[model samples]
Target: MVTVKMLKPYYIKADDNYVRVILAYQYFAVFINNKVYQFVPIESKEIRINRRTKKVENLGARFAFQKGKDIIYMAMSELISLPDFLVQLHSIADPYYLNKEIKSEPNYESEAIIDELEQLNMKRLIDKALDNRDYEAFQSLVKLL
Candidate 1:
């Protein structure tokens, strides 16, 4: 049996100046200021040998969203994770209100992840946090709920 994974919808936000995309625990890309950084899904390749004919076949995956493109592969021996990268982005946009709008919107990855979890009936966690007067947690949860 083939195992099927349920893909969360790609989180996207757009303004006249920028397009921000987050693929949840995977990667995020922000397109703005005439530059774009993308962290996208990638797959590994393997070589299979047919016993009967001794023929070798290379098998790999093409990303569902990035079809028909020449892919250049690169690896960083040491690198920051997506969450950290997002934090860096927020830091750079500081004093510019990129973290949230005036009313504390759910404008970041952590909030987006919480929103996804809440869709799975995890509201009680938020309620408990609110009950305990965890204002920070409450603020994060209240946006998407």
Candidate 2:
């Protein structure tokens, strides 16, 4: 029986389309029949996950990892059985999603303040143009209002 011992990603990068998870040596490991097998990315160091579907995208037919001098192969089918691994993976990716959500949310208070300031500045410019008897400048500034 295979069980995940540790699955901490070295770093995670996410965009609107996908989340890329990079793993390094000693960072991800598993246990098979109570024997530890450390995973080392051989074919590719990065795992690509679709953001919308939350599914592995770049994983080929089977992904290979190194354990000591021996290379072990794991299929996506095998990985699906381990609920703990999936849960931890999602937890690691959760922060990126939360950050995207936070960024997408509009800061209404700050936006209102900035708009008010711009209007006041434009009004001041219009008044100055009027005092200087610059009809062209006054007209342009008034148009901006």
Candidate 3:
């Protein structure tokens, strides 16, 4: 079962093999396997990643990123928090990105690509969700689409 934990994966280091998650607003304590790691809020919209291809052995329980730290390198990527909310809003949106992650491809039950020929007014759906206070639905669509 996949669920949004209100945490957004802001960065991933292939060399270091660490996934940095940042909270949208408050500092959330991520409890993974009994260890609690604090996530300082992310102010920037860009995804920051380390470019140096170096091996890091200490894949520890705690990783805290804050302001004033020097950015080694960054990828031109963007993702927002509240992903599950977005999914609930887009009833006819195609979920290509979500299906790509499934090990068992052709997750037919979930990922049926909606007809792109019919213009999906993404911005309108988003605005309506915001107005209706349907954040959960909005978040779901945001993560996959």
The candidate that wins on lDDT is 2
The CA lDDT at 106 in model 2 is: 90
lDDT of 2 by residue, 11-117 (tens): 88888888988888888888877778887676556767788677777655455666667788887667656888788888777655533343467989999999999
Clashing pairs in 1: none
Clashes of 2: 0
Off by over 4 Å in 3: 1-5, 8-29, 41-145
The TM-score between candidate 1 and the true structure equals 0.19
Whose TM-score is greatest here? Answer: 2
Superior by TM-score: candidate 1 or candidate 3: 1
lDDT of each: 0.40, 0.78, 0.36
Q: Least accurate stretch of 10 residues (summed lDDT) in model 2?
A: 95-104
Q: Any runs in candidate 2 off by more than 4 Å, and if so which?
A: 59-61, 98-145
**Alpha-carbon lDDT of model 1:** 0.40
The order by descending lDDT is 2, 1, 3
Query: Backbone clashes in each candidate structure, one number apiece?
Result: 0, 0, 17
Which is better, 2 or 3, measured by lDDT? 2
